[model samples]
Structures are given as structure tokens and as C-alpha cells.
Target: MAATVVQLTESKKHIQHTHRVFEEQKKAFRSNTMPSLAERQENLKRLKRALLTHQDRLLEAIDRDFSCRSRDESLIAEVMPSIQGINYTLKNLAGWMKPSRRHVSVLFQPASNQVHYQPKGVVGVIVPWNYPLYLAVGPLVASLAAGNRTMIKMSEYTPHTSALFKEIIEATFPEDLVCVINGEADVAADFSSRPFDHLLFTGSTSVGKMVMRAAAENLTPVTLELGGKSPAIVSPDVPMEDAAQRIAFGKAFNAGQTCVAPDYVLCPSDRVQAFVDEFRSRFAEMYPTLRDNDDYTAIINERQYDRLQGYIEDARAKGAEIIEINPAREDLKDGTRKIPLTLVLKTTPDMKLMQDEIFGPILPVVAYGTLEEAIHYINERPRPLALYFFGYDRDHQRQVVESTLSGGMCINDALMHVAQDDLPFGGIGDSGMGHYHGKEGFLTFSHHRAIFTKQKFNSGKFVYAPHGTAAHKMVYKLFIR
Candidate 1:
């Protein structure tokens, strides 16, 4: 039998509906129809209230989509941080909204120059399936805070959760100011093609290229978050067990269905086996039974499951050892897609896992004899989204941080750096582009209009006349000065 394919469709209705919605938002933004601070606060508070009320529902929907996402993980990854983003914007909007003062040259002292924050009219967001609510609502929160209209293209992989989110938003806000589109890639293509003041996309590098290409038709500014093979480097000084446990927890989270998840481990060669053994033991303890555990998140859908399964099988076929200290497998109606807690040994830089980003629950340990070799290996690849170093030495950590460039970093732990709302989250080069979350997100969705208020200064008239006389000499001196 031939395989089925996923592609964009010419769905006239979805396209028309999206165009109509964008048109409405464009009108609303032109009229400045969204609520003010007090009103937005109340409305966002209400939305947060709804989220709190439907917390369990959110968890259930995510669980349905991913098969094992838990309430606690959802809360920490999606709900709580989303609430924090809203609140952070709420408290700081007034300050962020203030027209920032600018320095004026002494020669042009009479003119006052300042930069004012203005809404970018309409903003479009293309959200990814992993952390659906967070990626979708995060930019939404920023746009809401910035007094802009927004429309989000929710991922098809998590249709249930997307529909639920739409219901939540529909119940709370006006359609023109805030809207959600439910469809597949064609819908997203249409969404990106529409004329918007800005568009933010969170997805793979290939998809990001398509989005950027489509957005170019409308001349819409975009924030593209792409993915790459992020590395985790464990120093020789740290305890192997502790490093393994921390990395195992991060790698196993969401079945490694994270954009910034550590794709491979580049560690000291002498300690590689020890690290692998420790990771196996720790992962086994953490996820005792993948079929029963709520914390063990599944792949977003079968397509992803198949892709990951392919990578694993190919790795095994090519002479890689798959270590499973605690096996979690079962035959299901969905055709047994579980790749429980995989740890690969004898993995060279040439393997598929090493060559490409592994967005699954597989941990491949890449061994090195020295920190320089590890550094060389990581430096040779495209800059990663996050660089992880686990050790007790602070100076060594500084050296690593100084020597390498990544979108973000963490010492002694992984994925924790992104949780802190203070740090700007983003990747560089092939991994991704642009930063968001916290104040950076606020700025990305806004336009800092350089407003130069000028008084009645004849300096313009003085320089306007073209002549080789005293006026020209004075103007030339002024220009020189």
C-alpha cells in the first residue's frame, strides 16, 4: 500500500473565513477598538480565571493529544507561565507604554525626540503542537498587553486542545480583536499569506521557511522559531549520577518533544559509559511504567511517532545499541508507537541522531576525551538553542559559557533556564531566529515609533537655502561640528 501524505489544500471556506477574520481585526486595530489597561486587565483576569477553571480540562485535552502529559507538567509548562506572562505585562504595561526619552544633539536642542510604543495593528501567530497553550497564548498575551489585535493558527496535531482554547477565548473576548483558526497546514499557509502587521511562527526549520516565504507575499514581519540539535555537555568533575539524572529528566520530558530539548550528549569519553548507566537507572526510576505514568508524555501524534520510530530503527540497523533498563511497550490500536526511554551507545557524529535534531525520547551519548574535543564538536555544529553544563566548578562554567554561543544555557540542570521569565528565550542560526517571552516578546509585537517633536526652529530654513554665501558657510561649519 502507498503511504498517505500531508499537504496544504485549497479550502476556500477556511481561506475566506481567515481573510474575513483578519479584515475585522485590521478594522478593529485601525479604530483602536480593544480595551484599555483597566479593561484589558479585567478581561485578561477573566481569561486567566477561565483557564484556572478549565485547568483540568486543559490537562485532559493535552493528555488526549500527547497520551501521557500530566496536570503538574501542564501547569508548570503552560498554565502557570502563561498566567505569569499576563500578570507581568499587566503590571509593567504602563512603564512599557511610556514614550522613551531620546538624546538630542546640542545643535538641534530646540527639537525634542522620543520613541513611543505603538501597536503593530494586527498580529498573527502560528503555534506548534508541543506546549500548544504556551506558544499560542504567549504571543497572544504580549499582543493583548500591547493593545493589538491577534489571530492564532493552532496546530492540527492538538486539535482538541486548540478547539478548547478557541472556546475559552470566544467566551471571553470579541471576535474582531482576538480570533483562532482551526485547520491544517493549508490554513496556516493562508494565515501566513494574509496581510498582517506582524506574524510569529513556532515550528520546525522547514516549516519556518515556508511560513517566511508565504509571509513575504504580504510583506509581513515574522518571528520564526526553528529547531536544531541542541547539545548537553557534562564536565568531568561532576558526579555522573547527578548529571545523568538531571539530563534524563529533561530528555524524557514530553518524550523529548521539545524544540529546545537536548538532542545529544557530548561528554568526557572516560565517563561516557558511567553516564549512560546512570541515565538508564534514573530514567527507569522516574518513569516506572510508561503505559501507567502520567508524567511520561507521548509524541504529539502518529506522524511524529512514525518519524521518531524511523530514527530509532535506522539507528539500530546501523549498528547502534538501544539500551532500555525499564522497557515500556504495548500493542495498541494506534500500532504501538511508544519508544520508551531509549539510550544509544556507540553513536558517532555520522549517525542520523547526531546529524539531525532528534525530537523524541531518545538520548544519544557522544563521548569525548577532553572538554576541548567536546567544545570542538559542539562548535562545529550549528549553534544550539540551549547549552547545558553540569558541574560544581563556577569558573569552568564561565569558560564554557564564554567559549560557546547558544540561545540559552543552564548549569547543573536542563530546560530550567527557559522557565525563568526574566531571561529572554530564543535560538540562533539554523536552530532558530529571534527571542521572545518576558519583555522581549512585548517588544517584538510592538513598534517603537521614533516620534521627533520639533519646535519652531529656523535651523531647517537656514540650511534649506543653497548658496555659496555666509549662510552656506555657517551651515557647512554647523554640519562639520
Candidate 2:
């Protein structure tokens, strides 16, 4: 077992490296406790320049990692969002860094109060395989803008992209200021256990539990971007074509490997067939062929491919109707790992597809008798990371918004809410917790330290020692009511 010995050696090496780098980052952060706004903006600008300079290489690495990842999809989903996020951070970081002044009460007229957004010492970002570049860059932008040293752990499944990212980051930033760590599961576990001021993990809910538990050992604050079965609700009054097209895009983009992708659709009972037909039509228009189409993205690996295929088989065995929308009718079993948009009808709660977050190009359309029933169905389950409502009726939209709870919601669109730089992205309950993006992202990695100042006066001394004194009684009588 020479391979086993080699693997053990590599694991030990990675663990030791992680420990050393972590301590170095902590020391670096202590040296420069608070970086000026100009420094943070310059860091963002350098990051943006690096991403643009090596754009082609980054795309090629992602394509190689997936075996058949779409070049255009990489640009649209990964590169564009990353660059935009950095620009957004650069433009707004100055305002975000300014201390927020608080109003002092009349009883404390001689004092001033404010909150300084100080950087937490160092931040740990664990990136997932799907959309690795964007996920890593998104959190990294926020961490840098908040003036903290960062250590990124890239997914081992995407070796090509992960290695390339590490190279790019090393060339652009110093080890103590920023570093990238790459390894397998054991390495990830070790990386998670390292003490950091804050940690942000983006991955599956099951694995999220392990990361959170590991972080708990050090009482590390974490912002988990976990995924669940995000759903899209189609209103009876909304046009089937519009709803179907948007949902199809959400499900087909990157082969539905997105965390916020619409996992299922709750369509009106009588319109289920119509919605299916429209969805098929729209998806075909986008991807006429699967096997040879460079526009279509393949699953990351054979294991993931098998897992998706197993879901389809399990649903079929459970009596669900499986509809494959392969417009060209090509044989996709050529080991390309490309899966067409497969729709499941009449899905039962017992099926694996319904129980788990289907993170592939599989959409399950469940029929609901009424809007109330649809709301009831979603309310019964764990709150999703994102919920999409496709309808034009103002009253119905309001009803859905007021009735249910989710981490984020989009009206008349799917997956676009995440692209908006102004909004915060996060989850609730089992889906995930903690917000990031824009100001929320800056605040997530920062500590709002409250400060109170007084000069040549001591208003608080009146109530300090003698609680029954006249000054204390007057102060209490003036404010306690």
C-alpha cells in the first residue's frame, strides 16, 4: 500500500502547513490591527485586476475540472459575479468602514457614543466545488474589505480549478495576508478545526453540520451558506410560458448545480401539464442537444453523475413520471457526465428526490389544489434558502411573503436575487444562517465595537457609589419611567 502511505504523508504535511499559516496570519493581523479604507480599496482593486488578468486560465481550469463545463456559463456565473462583487465592495467600503455615530441620551449630554467596525483578526473561507471561483471570491472580497487576513480552503473535488486559484492567489497576495489551502476531506476537517476569528462555509447541509461542530471547538463565529430544497411557486394567474422559462433557466443553468437553484416547482393542479409542456419547450430552445452541445455543462464527476442517476431511478421506481427533455435525442451515456433537464411529476414525500436537495438538472413539479395548500406544504418543511414566486398579482405576492419564511425571496424571477449587489444572501433554520454580500458581508466579518467618550466631565459618577443619593434618585426619576 504505497499509495496509502503517500496519502498519509500528504495529509500530515497539509495539516502542519495549515497550522503554520494560521498562526502567521494571526500575527500579521495583530501587527496591522485596523487597516485604513484606502488600503482595503486597494486590495480589492488588486484582486479585481488579478481575476481579470488570468480570466482565461481560470475558465480553462474550471472547464477541465468538470470535464465539460460550459465556457459561457463560467463567464456568466463565475467570472462576472466575482468581478462585480469586488467592484461593489470597492465602491462602498469607505462608507462601510466609517464609525456609526449613536445619539447620546439627555442624561448623558456630556458623553458621546458610536460603534467602530473593527476587523475580526482573520477569516477562514471554505469554498464548494460548484461555482468555486465566485463563492471563494465573494467571501474573500468581503473579508478583505473588512480589513482581515484570509485563508481559503478550496474543494478537492475541483482539483484543477482549486490548484489554479491557489497559484493566482499566491502570486497576488502574501502568505500572511492571504493564502489558499487545498486537500481532501481529512485536510478540510483539519482546516476547519484551526482557530480563526470568523469562518464562512459554503456547501451541503450535512457537511455544514460537521464544519459547524469543528468551529464550535474554538467557539468560532461562522456564516454558513448551506443549501436545501429551494422551491418556486407558480401562481394560477401568472403566464405559464413566463414562469416555465424562468424556472427552466434556473434549473438548467450550470446543470442546476447551484445552491439557490429552484429544486422543485409547486404548480397549480390543473396547470401541471401545461407547465411541464412549457418547461420542456423552453429548455429545448436553450439546449437542443446535450451530449455534443458545448453550452450544456456536465456533472462534476462520475460519482456525482451516479448520485443524480440514482435519484432518477429511485423516483421512477416510486411511480413518479420521469420526463427527459433531450431535444436532439442523443445518447448521453458516452461518459461525458452530461444530464439533460429531467422533470419528475407526482413526486411523493417518501422518494429520495423529494427528501434531499437535488443539486442537479432535475426538477420535480408538485401539483397543489390551491394557494393555501401550497403555502401549507412549504410551511410544513424546513425554511429554504430561497423561495421564488412567479406571479403578477400584488395581493397574492403579499400573501405569500407575509405567510411563509425563508432566507431570501424573489418575485417574478428565480436565482436573480443573488446577483443583486445591494441585497444580502443567507439562509434560515436548516437551510443555513448568517448574511453576507454588500454591507451585510462587511458586517459579518467585522466586530461592531461600541465606544463611549466623555471629556472633563463625569456624568455617570452621580449614580456610581450611592444608589440612594439625591442625584441618583433624580436621575432615576427622570429616566426610569
Candidate 3:
């Protein structure tokens, strides 16, 4: 009881500290509300430099947090995207910052219209554990590009990575310009409650709700990158071998911890067994051995490991077929948190694995009769973050793209859309809301203030007279008609 009281006190102190820092950042934003293009670019450059300088340390720290995070996967999925995002912002910041001109109607020809993209004061970003560095840096790139002061709240699950990120940020920037906050769930709650110009959170849907509710008190606009059961559909036209290999890579990468990872596969009824066979073969080709394979990432923690194990157990009890893909058949009971690539077939709707976002290397394959059936299956559920369709036919692709709704869709590919710098990445409905990446990200953190400029000529004097006069009637006829 005493310990609990002490913990609560500490939590309050942490929240207070977060609020204090937030105030300081707000003040800084007020001082320089709209930073010049050079300043914003320099900020991004410094961030890129710091990240590169501490790249090795960051990767090692993330590995420690996950017990065994794949170094190559970290480079490809996290580091590469962060660096690319910075470069993309730098390459286009000048053009993005320029005021865009808009045409004025003929009646208002004497006036000119333009939109100035101004920073939205301070921005609060809450980073998630999976792909921690990428998620943090991605939003930071957008915020800086939009010329906003930022405060980042690192996830508690990845303590080592969070601590290291804090060190890097403190060394590269001032507390007011950019600050990092670290704590548990209570601290996250407090951080979300604080009023900010804008807030961005990347995590689960359930937590996203609480964050949104807290932000609602302050009327803070948010960009939530929440996760859901993102699905991948294997069309009958595409080769089973090709579809299986791509889906396998997407699911196995990061041990299927990616929010955009293919949660389950929809294969044609006749191709279900073929997909299973091809997927197993492809997974083996990627990682022949699981226990000692550095390429195969382990579950983030024991709790997560146990949760995944329970999913398999419950599915088994429910009569779902479970295929554990341990090419080497190594014993997993020797204190190893590694879970072999698993495929759960014949998954019932009542099973927990089918009900929730399975953020592990567990692929569930569901059989469908036709493409429309596949589309219907996805439409019935809550919108997903990403949807993958593997087919070469442009007509079928167009149909799938138009008929279904997802945060993003990848046609004839998997997990590659996010790598494109020109694309805006985010979710829809239950998956998430708002967008980040490319120009959309800059817009998300910026306020597009529309401005109208009138010259010495008063064209509006025609309608400014008291009551309806000849000039008012003439103006009304000229414009309204």
C-alpha cells in the first residue's frame, strides 16, 4: 500500500514536469511562430546528423528492448524511412513554405487570394514501441518542416531506446525547441491531457480512444496512427508463389509487429492449401533457422510472448489448425522468447486471434469464393490501416481499390507503399485518422491561413450602400446571375 502511494506521487511529479516543459515549448513557439525555410531545414539537418551519429547505439538499444530486434530490419524499416523523410522534407521545404495563390472570382477581381502555411504553435507527439525511432522521427520531420516546436513522449515499453533517444535529442536541441518525456501509462495520460497546438499518437486503437478523449478537453487536433487488422488479399489470378513470398516477407519482418503487417490472408477457396504451402516455403527461404537466426526478431517481451502463445492455445482449443514453421524444429522451452512463424488456418470468428490485431508472426488464412466475397469480408469489419491486393489485372485492381476502404492500399505489392516519399500514410475510421508523410504531413502540422488582399481600388463599394440601391441591384445581377 505504501509503495503504491509512493508510485502515485512519482507519477504526479512526472506529469507536472511534462506540463511544465510543454508550457516552455509553447512560449518558444510564440516567440518564433513562423520559422524561415533555412531555419527549418537546418533543424531537420541537425536531427538527421544526430540520428546518424547515434545510429549504432539506437539500433543496439532497440535490440535490447526487444531481446533480439533484427539489425537489418531496423535499418530497412526504421532508420531508412527516418532518413528518407528528412531528406524529402529538405528537398521540398522551400516550395512547401511558399504561399500558394488562388484565383479570385470575376466580381472580386480587384482582390487577390492566397494561402499562407503557418506553423500550429507547439506539437505533441506520442511515440509507440514498435519501430520507435521511425515513428518519432517521422512526425518530427513533419513538425519541423511545418515550423512547429515539438515535445515527444517516448513509450515506456522500450525503456532503453527511449532513454537513448532522449539523450540524442537533448544533445542536439534545447528543451524549449524540442523536449523528450519518459514515463509509464500514467505519465502518458497526463501528457495527452495537456493542451497543445496539435498532437499525434501512434499506437493501438483502444489507447487511441483515450488519447483522443483527453485531447478533446482542450480541443486539440490530433493525427492518430492507430493499428487494426490490416488485411492482404490473394487474387486467384496472381501466382500463389509470388503472393505467398511477398505476404510472408511483410508478416515476418519485425516478427509481424508492424502495424501495416498483413494480419490475415484472404485466398480463393481452391488456393487456400496452395497459399499455405507456398507461404511456408517462402518463410523457410527467408529464415531457415529461428532460434539463432539474427534476421528473425523475437517477441518484444515475455508478456507479449505469453499473449501470442495463449492465442495459439485458444485457437487450438477452438478447433483452428495451427502450423508452427520451425524449419529446424528447435526446442523453444529453453528460456528463449523466440516464436517460430505460425500460420493459423480455419480460424473461427469467435477466436481471439481473428477478433484482434495479431501483432506477431501469426498469419491466419481465410478461404473466399470470389473477389467480391473477399471484398465483402473486409468491408464488414472495421476499416484497416493497410490493405494489400496481389493481382496483375488492372480491371480487378481498380474494382478492389474502388469497392473497399482502408487507410492505404498496396496493389500487387506489400509494405512498399510506405517507402514512397510522395505518398501520405495514415489510417481510416477505426484504424486511425488524419495523415502524415509527404506534403500531407506538412499540412497536418500546419495551419493553411487563407488571406485576401485588396488594393486601393474599392470594388466592394457597389454593395456597401444602405438598403438596396441601383449599384447593389447591378452588382447582384452581375454576380448572382
Candidate 4:
């Protein structure tokens, strides 16, 4: 089925609306002292309150957007993580904002130095569609916590949810303080061109580049949360059933629309059948029937549906065997229908699935005879956003950890590693350019200014330029490297 092209008029109305909102917020930001720690706490509390009030809508919109997002999963995965992030920021904001006292060497004892943390003037955050609420609000909360005015661009793919989000925000915050723009991709290009003190983007690597290039025109600093081919390694030592359950949950969650969803899997060749059998059984148990299974989400839109469909057809054409796990249902509908979850076997490196990030309900099993082959295979690809190793062998886990590089690690699990707000979450290289979550999220939108305050006595006059030869000699001996 073909997708209906959604056209965006970067019409004068959009430009005028955006400009008026951005300027008003810019004025508000300039006039307001970055919120005090007390104010930030109040803001976080308000945000949490708003979410709690609107939790039902969030669940509905997310459910509507993805055919099968569980309310429990949304609350836990999206809502709670955001709350925890807010709480973490509240607990640490004071210390994070405090000026740091720097040591004054004996030779420069008269001078006292410090560093002041300040917010960026204005920030632009562009969110992806998979986890719209969390993706938009997480950074927005952090930006607000850091005392910066912000503008957000929500994915058009999630228009209903995005519009609802805007309404919720409108109820809580002044448009001058924050604005949510929802339109097609071209509007996103326009949003990126807006002058921003700092810009953060979460999406594919290709779009990240376009955002970066657009920001470059204004010399704006950018934090890119890009996607890559993240890998998961299932060690032979782990309980086969347990490993399969955890892997299957991560792969199937959100219909595998997550940025850090394990793009591929590696396991010992001997254990491959057991793992596959377990995965199939566990997935079936989890989703006894796809027709009424609310836990299974649909492809975001037809374009992605077709893109994934193409990847599937290409892989099948190239001789890869696909296991159709989607139960045969009499109710299977048209284009927006659910594509079957496929487990690919005997996959070659040259296959289409292996060449790109498979952001769908598809998992490819690449078996290795030895651990070194797995390590080599992982290293050969760009470092992934997240890496999973399912085993109880602490020694092997540590060895893999030491030998390989990834943005974050889940020793015995998968995607849930991101839900821990206590950790810094972001990817590396093609995966992402920087981290944000918890305090790191706050820090990413701030500029730390180092300072010095000397006593009125001016004892540091000794370090001034009118020095005699003897004074210079003494200063060099005591302070110069």
C-alpha cells in the first residue's frame, strides 16, 4: 500500500506564529533570572502534576499512535522515567548550579577563583515519534530546570499526540515560556534554522546531520541523539529461557521502534536453536494472538511500513529464511496493518537487514562459534547506542565490557537500561553525539563560567605586570610551569 504524502506549507502563518512565540519567549528568558532552585523544584512538581493529570490522554494518544502501547508500559517506560528524571534534577540542581571554588596556588594566594553555571539563552528540542511524550518532555523539563526558554518540534507522524501535548503544555505554561510546533519534515528544517543557544535532536543519523548542518548556519551548539545498529549478545552461560524472554521483550516492545532496540543478536551457534525456540515460545506466550494483542504496536506510518516491507522483501529475495511469527489472523486489514514479527536465519552480512538499523519487529540471529567472533562482529560495526549481554558470568561480562565500546551497557537485560534516570543516556559516533538524562541532561543545556574574586585588599597586585626582575624571577620560580 502507498502512503499519502503529507504536505507542509511553511506558509507565512507558520513563520509568523513561530517568530512571535520565539521572540516572546526570548523576551521572557532575558527578563527572568534563570529560575532559582526553589523555582525549579516548583516547576518539576508542576510538570509531574500535569503528567499525572494527563496520563490518560498520553496513554490514549500513544496507543492510538502505536497500535499496541500498554498503559502500564507507557506509565512505567515514559511517564515514570520522566518523573524520576525530574526528581533527580530537583535533588541535584542546587549543587549543579552552585559556583565551584577553585584552589589558589600559594604564589597566587591573593586571588580566589570560582565557576558559575548559567543556562543557555534559548533552546530548541526536536523529538522523535516512538516515545513522543517522554522524548519531548524529558528534555523540556531539563531545559526548564536549567533556566532556559525552549521551543520544541514534535514529529508529524504523531500529530494527534503532539497536538494533545501542546494543549497540555498550554494549560500549564505560557506560550512565551514554551511552544510546541507540529507539521511535516520541512517545518522541522525551518525549526532547526531558528536561532537557538543550544539545539538537541533525537532521531535517525541522516536527519541528525541535516539538523546539525542547519544549526551550523547560526553556529549553534547541538547534541544529537542519533540511531545506529545496536547489538545484543546472548552468552551460552545464561538460562536460555530467561535470555530469550528478555531479548524478545526488548525486540518486540514498541514494535521495535525504539532507537536503541537491539538491531541484531549474536549467540553461540550450538545454542542458536534453543534460543530461537525459546524466543518463539516466549513471544507466543506474551502475545497469544496479535489481532487483539494491545501490546503490539503498528508501524508508525505507511512510508516506514513500506520501508520495512522493502527491507523484508530484499532480505527474503537474497536467500535469508524468515520465520513469520505473526499468527495467521482472519482480521488482517490493509496498509496500516501489523507486519509479522520475523526471525531471520542464515543471514549473511551482505543482506539488507544486516546493512541498516532494522527498526521494526524483526530480529536477526548471527551465530558465532567463539566469543572473539562476536566481539569482532560488534566492533566492525559502529558502536551502538546500547549493548546487551545476557548471562550471569560476571567474568565474561566484564571481559566483553572491557573489550567493546558502547554508549551504555545492560549486563543481563536490554532496553530498560535507558529507564534508569540515575544514569547518563546517549549514544556514540553514528549512534549519537552526546548524552542527556538526569544531571547530564541539565548540564548539556548550560554553560559553566569560571570566575575569580579577590579580596578588596588587592594582595594579588604582586602578580600584576609592573614586576621588577627579582619579582618576575620569584613569580616564575613559584608559579610558572
Best by TM-score: 2
- Rank ordering of all candidates by TM-score, starting from the highest: 2, 3, 4, 1
lDDT score, residue 386, model 2? 94
- Itemize residue pairs with steric clashes in candidate 4: none
The models' CA-based lDDT, in order, is 0.81, 0.94, 0.93, 0.84
Candidate 2, residues 236-304, lDDT tens digits: the string is 999999999999998899999999999999999999999989998999999988898889999999999
Each model's total of backbone clashes:
1, 0, 0, 0
Candidates in order, TM-scores: namely 0.93, 0.99, 0.98, 0.94
**Model 3 agreement with the true structure over 1-481: per-residue lDDT tens digits:** 9988987888888788888888888888889888998899999999999999999999999999998999999999989999999998899989998999999998886899999999999999999999999999999999999999999999999999999999999999999989889888999998998898999999999999999999999999999999999999999889989999999999999999999999999999899889989998999999999988899999998888999999999999999999999988999767678898899999899999999999999989999999999999999999999999999889899999999999999987888998899999999999999999989999999999999999899887777859599888888787785
Cα deviation at 195, candidate 4, in Å, is 1.5
Give a tens-digit lDDT track for model 4, residues 261-369: 8888898999988988999899888876776666667788888888887887888998988887865443545644576678988898788889888899888999998
Top candidate when judged by lDDT against the true structure: 2
Candidate 4 overall lDDT versus native? 0.84
Better of 1 and 4 by lDDT: 4
In candidate 2, which residue pairs get closer than 3 Å at backbone N, Cα or C atoms, i.e. clash?
A: none
| Residue 397, candidate 2: C-alpha displacement in angstroms | 0.6
Clashes of 2: 0
Worst 10 residues of 1 by lDDT: 1-10
